[model samples]
Target chain A: MISYMLCLVLFSVGLYCILRKRNVIKIIIGIGIMEYAANLFFVLLGYRTHGRSPIYAIDQEIKSMVDPLTQSVVLTGIVLGLSVTLLLVAIAIRIYERYGTFDITKITKLKG
Target chain B: MEISFIAIPLASAFVVAMIANLDERIQDCIACLAALATLTLSLFAITVLSGAGSSGAIVYKVGGWVPPFGVSIVIDGLAAFMLVTVNLIALAALFYSTGYMKKYTDKWKFYALFLLLLAGINGVLVSGDVFNLYIFMEIAAIAAYALVAFGTTAEELEASFKYAVMGTVASCFIFLGIAFLYGYSSTLNMADMASVLASKGPSGALLLASVLFLMGFGLKAALAPFHAWLAYAHSSAPAPVSAMLSGVVIKVLGMYAIARIFFNVFGITPVISFMILTLAVLSMIVGSMLAFVQSDIKRMLAYSTVSQIGYVALGLGVGTPLAIFGALFHLFNHSLFKSLLFLNSGSIERVAGTRDMGKIAGILDKAPLTAYTGLVGALSICGVPPLGGFWSKFIIILACIQAGRPILALTAVVVSILTLAYYFKSYTPVLFGNVTTSKQIKAKSLFTMNAPMVALTVLVALAAFILIPVVGNVFMDGAVASLVRGISYTDVVFEALK
Candidate 1:
């Protein structure tokens, strides 16, 4: 329960970075942090107190195993997160080229 | 054949990307043909479902895996209905982009992203598992963010950055929600999870998961309070991308997910309905008012999308069969007319080289096709009496009244009127005035651009009659029945598997 609370606290910190940061790169990092928090929570959900690795071998006997499904889901989530991060970074680079600033406030060409 | 809905688009996107060395025109044909193929399959799905009756669905288990353990592609009334809407708009956007994309240097890249976007949308609509749904949602969302910044202009990049950041946060919320649900039910299959959730009754974890999903999907759909990113994103992207984004992305990823999960998976509680109703009311009033104040043409349309989504949410919030039917019908109509309107704006921007409604005066003579078709789109979106939009808003309000929510019904009616006011005020300067300014409209309205507008105009006019029993049987009723079935959806999928 405490670990779950820790995961959510990390998630909240990322949300704060997204909401409060002015630099585009910092916000992208925040996005990465948020994704990892969710990934960590998924890991926690599948964990057993003394769980063995979820692997199969004809020669070995297993008493208990962690949920393999959440591990696989986390792996997929990480790849997706990488794609998002790379795209965000690429867009940030292009933004710097156009506006010549990292500050989001100065990037006001799209305002109402 | 169920696999064809996804495979064809995926193959076409791959083909488009691989042939980057070839002439750009080839990729355009590839994208259109891919869209046409899925549309044919979508039509086929409808025919098959209409005959199979209520419990009938097309269930395709990936790699020959069974329902609960593998990624199952299930096409039911709801999925089929959404498929048709998505593919239809996708086809139009592909055709429009052929002409519209010439202004940009690289055409092949645009077709690649566009087809991938279609593939992602189709994947979302067809997948029966929450995990698959998340994967596809990311695919579509990522494609959309990249396409929005395709111009590489400062404004487009700014909008894309903001949209991407907010979208990432929303997705994380959704991902965490999925984790919570997984922990509670120990299954990612939506139908199976629905059964588990039903058997478990209400719990604290379920409550948290639902609230997290509400925030995630609501932000994607751009509900009133979470709608800061939409105006800039819509106004900044190229027009066809704008059309696709506004037309179906929000509906499939946001509204459709909300309806499917809340109604089917989680089973809507009084608390859930109350929360949805609150959001609906706020979205309707705020979106329309904000839209009315916007000077940019696409931004105005974007805000109106927020308002229109409110109507759909209101119907879902009411949670009666009639209201869900109204909501689905309105969703279909909005996709058509909104895409038409966005396409029209693209054409206007292409010819006049500007999107400022105040400046592009009296374009009827300069671009007759855009002016006339845009008028149809404008009227349709405004919910004019004979057009499709009117029927949807009327039904939603009627449902609210029947559900004994007079205040909500009144809100829907007033918001509909507000919709008319904004469309009227904005289009007056755009369509009615004479071209007296020095801006020489340099571009000619081409056949590629005008064709989609005309096609969509005819569709917009005819979309109103779709709710009639004869047509609705094939198109709308299946969608409503599937949702009405709710938790029994698991039985339907299991039955189809056998």
Candidate 2:
């Protein structure tokens, strides 16, 4: 429960960064932090107290095993998160080159 | 056959990347051929699906592992419908890009990202597991971010950055929701999860998961409150990308995901249905009202996307068989006309050298093909009678009335009129007024560009003419039955697996 609360706090902090920050790079960082928080929560979801790695052999007795599914999912999520982060950084760099500033407010060419 | 939907595009994307060093002519030929193949395969799938019984959903287990253990591809009425929409729009967008993308260098990279995005959308539509769905969503989302920043201009980059940030945050919420669901159900397969959820009544954790999903997918769908990034990212992208984004991406990524999760995995309740309807109403009102204020052609179309999606959401929210049919019908029709309209905008931008409506005038006398197509598209979108939009909107509102929600039905009527009003306002200045400006207007390209607009314009007209019989059996019945079946989905899956 405490761990879940910690995850929530981390998520809120990331949200604040995304909502309040004006710098494009900083907003990207906020997104990274949020994804990391979710990934952490996924890992925690599969954790067990003193649980062994989930593997099986013909002779081994089956006991408490940490869920293997969340680990695999988190691994995929991490990879995807990395790609998204890279794309964000690349876009931010290009934005800086074009607008001459990382500030989002200065880059207001598109509007309704 | 199932894998081909994904494999074909994935291979094409790789080939495009490899052949980026080649001459432009070869690149254009490869890109057009690949896109045509995808479109043909999707049409074939639709035929196969039309013959399938509601009880006959096909599941292709990856690596020959049974579902609930390994990943599987489940193709059903709904999946087939969405696949057809995505692929058709992709084909049209590719054709448009062939002409529109000449201005930008490195045509190969553009097609590569486009095909990659197509593969991702198909993968998401067919995946049976929750986690794999997220994976495919990421694939699509990531590709979309790159495509939005393809121009790498200040405005494009800024919009792309903002879109990426908002989209990533939404993805985080989705992942968190999935984690909660997995923790509770101990299964990742949607069918198996539904069974587990049924066995265990709705819990606080499940409620939390639902809320998380609503927020996350809501952001993706661009519901009224979460719609800030859509107008920016959509209008800022190049025309074909904008077409694909507004045409089918949001629908597949947002609405399809929401429908699959809500109606299949988690049974719909009145409260949840009401919440969806409220959001739908808000989107309809806000999107149309806001669109009335936009001068940029594509930007107006972007807001119209929001309004059209509202009709879909409202239909889904009603949760009646007829209502679901209305929603799905509107979804397909919107994809057709919206893509056509976006391509039309691209043509206008190409010919007149501007997207600003206030500055540019008299596109009709200048470019006859684009003007006519734009007129047809506008009529279809505004729910004008004898056009595709009218029938779908009529059915949806009728369904609302039949479902005893007259107020929502009334709101639907008013909003659609608002839709007509805004579309006409945008259309008149560009397509109808006198040609005073002496900008040299020429066709963008013959095979790659003009063909798509012509074909899609024909389809928009054909959809309107064929509304009665074609839509009756193919879309309306299928979508309605899918929604009507509801939680019985769990029973069917468990029985099939057993």
Candidate 3:
């Protein structure tokens, strides 16, 4: 229960950074943090009090195992996060080249 | 055959990326051919599904694994309907891009990303596993991010960055919802999850999951308060990209997912329905009101998209069979006219050298074809009678009244009129007034660019015929029936998997 609360706290922090940060890079990091928190929560959902690795062997008996599906899904989510982060960083670099600043407030060329 | 919807585009994207350097024109040929092929497949799927009846959904398990264990692709009435709408717009936009993208340096990269985006949209339409759907959504979303930034202009980059950040946050929320759902049901397959949710009944966890999903997908669909990213993202992208973004991306990624998950998987509760209704009404009023004042052509169209999507959401919120039918029909019609309008704007931007309506005038004399098509698209979107938009709006309002929501029905009517007013106010001066610009019009509306607009114009004009009893019974009724069946989707998909 405490771990879940901690996860929510981490997610809130990331959301705060995303909402409050001025630097494009900081916002990207914030996105990464939020994604990590979600991923952590997913892993926690599958955790047991003393669960062992989810593996199969013909020779050995398995008693308890953590849910492997959430782990695999989280791994996929991490890959997606990596791609999004890489793309965000790449775009940030291009933005810096054009605007010559990392501050998002100054990058306000597009408006209604 | 079901997998071919994803495989063909994926392969084509790969080919475009690899062989792009060999020849400049080859990428264009490949991308168009791939889009055409997918469009053909979607048409075939539609016919097959309609012929097979409502119980005839096809479930193709990945690697021959059954549900609750392996991923599956389910092609039902709704998927088939959405597939046709998505592929049709995709084909037109790819053709338009061939000409419009010549202004940019790297045409091949654009085709590559475009095909990748198509692959993602098709994948999202057909996937039966919730996690698989998320993966595909990410694929489409990432490709869209890159495409939005394709121009590398300052405005485009900033818009793309903002869109990317907001979109990613939405994805995180969606992922969190999925995690909660997986934990509750102990399954990732949508059908299995639906059955589990049904057996378990309503719980706090499920309620939380639904709210999270609403926030996430609502942001994606640009519903009401979550719509800030749309105007920037849709207006700043290249015109064809904007067309695809407005035409089908939001519908498939945002609206379709919402309908499938809320109505089918979760079984729409009264609370959810009420929440959706409130958002729909808010989006309808606010979006059109915002659109009325935009001077930029694409920006107005973008806001109009937000407004129009409200009608779709309203229909879904009403949750009557007729209302869902209206929503689906409007979804198809919007894709047609919206893509046409955006493509027409691209042509105007190319020839008139500006998207600012104040600076451009007398398009009817300058580019008669573009002007006429834009007029048709604008009129259709404004819900003019005998055009596609009118019938859908009529049905939605009628459904609202039938469902005993008189005030909501009244709002729909007034919003429809407001939609007409704004579309006319923005487009009339550009299409009909005297030539007023001092800039030299390039006058190079190429055949490739004009062809798609003409095709879409014809579609926009003729789409109303589908509302006839004979055609609607055959095509639209199937989709309506599937959604009306609601959580029975689980049984149908499970039976198909057998």
Which candidate ranks first by DockQ, i.e. highest? 3
- Candidate 3 residue lDDT tens string, A55-88: 8889988788899898899999999999999999
lDDT of 3 by residue, B1-498 (tens): 999999999999999989967876788889999999988988887778777444658789899898879999999889988888899999999999988898899788898899999999999999999999999999999999999999999999999999999999999999999999998999999999999999999999999999999999999999999999999999999999999999999999899999999998999989999999988999999999999999999999999999999999999999999899999999999999999999999999988989998888888888899999999999999998999999999999999999999999999999999999998888998988788557567767999999999999999999999978887766787688779999999999988766
User: Candidate 1 at A101: error in angstroms?
Assistant: 1.0
Better of 1 and 2 by DockQ: 1
- Tell me the number of clashing residue pairs for each predicted model: 1, 0, 0
Candidate 3: regions farther than 4 A off: B52-54, B437-439
Give each model's whole-structure lDDT: 0.91, 0.86, 0.93
Clashes of 1: 1
Candidates ranked, most accurate by DockQ first: 3, 1, 2
Q: Model 1, B314: alpha-carbon shift in Å?
A: 0.5
**Winner on DockQ (2 vs 3):** 3
User: Which candidate achieves the best TM-score against the true structure?
Assistant: 3
How would the docking of model 3 be graded? high
lDDT for each residue of candidate 2 in A18-66, tens digit (9 for 90 to 100):
9999987778788888888899999999999889997889999867889
What lDDT score is found at residue B41 in candidate 2?
Answer: 75
User: What's the lDDT for residue B411 in model 3?
Assistant: 96
